[model samples]
Target: MTGPTYRIEVALTAARQLRKLDHPARRRIQAAVELLASDPRPPGAKKLVGGEGEWRVRTGDYRIVYEIHDHVLRVLVLAVGHRRNVYRRSSGVARKART
Candidate 1:
């Protein structure tokens, strides 16, 4: 409630990735996603390295990769996966970044 609510949009790649997770993990991720709508940079969220406006939220072993578009007041989720390999692969959101 600190700022304007951000519209959360999950990319197809991210949605697909989310669908692959187990039930409990999916629930946690869903809760995290809801939080992002209210606070794009919620507590415990981290800015991902090598990208402007890119951030990550952790839920157990899973990671939610997202980008904040300030002007548009939107949050686009780029990827969703486990900690071990989430950063290793290029997500749709990551690919869209200039740097």
Candidate 2:
């Protein structure tokens, strides 16, 4: 018995970052993103501190930063990149989304 799924919206920045990834990494990350539609907080996902409702999931060395809007039932992907820089970049991306 699956529940209603959330709509996934990839921000332009995140989309661009995803496009720059290598083939296998891209595929794996895409799969993980899609899964959020059904389970936005899947196993291993973590709610980021000071992220203003943001959550993150990992796929290998890469990380996908996103936010779940329950009222709208949407999953907004804010950024995607290597673990080292994704967090730093996502905060800026998320700020842009607000304005």
Candidate 3:
């Protein structure tokens, strides 16, 4: 039997963004997010320098930005977007405005 896995929590903005994506893109990102539940630091996952505990993974031209909380065993997905635009904005800027 499998042991416990980190829970995946998607931000509202990230969920909206995911919903707007094409079917293939959505599937790819969904798979990546699910993988984070089992392996928060999976191969090629990079820890973003400015945000402590925040990590990122890639799927094609898309990027998944998330943070791992060991205490709660959760993976919070903060953002997802194209490589060229994902890192351009501050994470907190749009969260409150839309949520």
Candidate 3 weakest lDDT stretch, 10 residues: 90-99
Higher-TM-score candidate among 2 and 3?
2
**List of clashing residue pairs for candidate 3:** none
Better of 1 and 2 by TM-score: 2
lDDT of 1 by residue, 1-99 (tens): 266889999988889988999999999999999899988987888776567668888888888888889899999998898887776663433322132
The prediction achieving the highest TM-score against the true structure is 2
The best-first sequence of candidates by lDDT reads 2, 1, 3
Candidate 3: Cα lDDT at 67: 80
Q: Give candidate 2's error at residue 1 in angstroms.
A: 1.3
Candidate 3 per-residue C-alpha lDDT over 1-99 given as tens digits, one digit per residue, 9 for 90 to 100: 765699899988788778888999999999999988888888888777656667788899998888889889999888888877676643642222111
Leading candidate by lDDT = 2
lDDT tens readout by residue for model 2, 1-99: 998799999999899999999999999999999999999989888877655888888899998999999999999999999988897777553322221
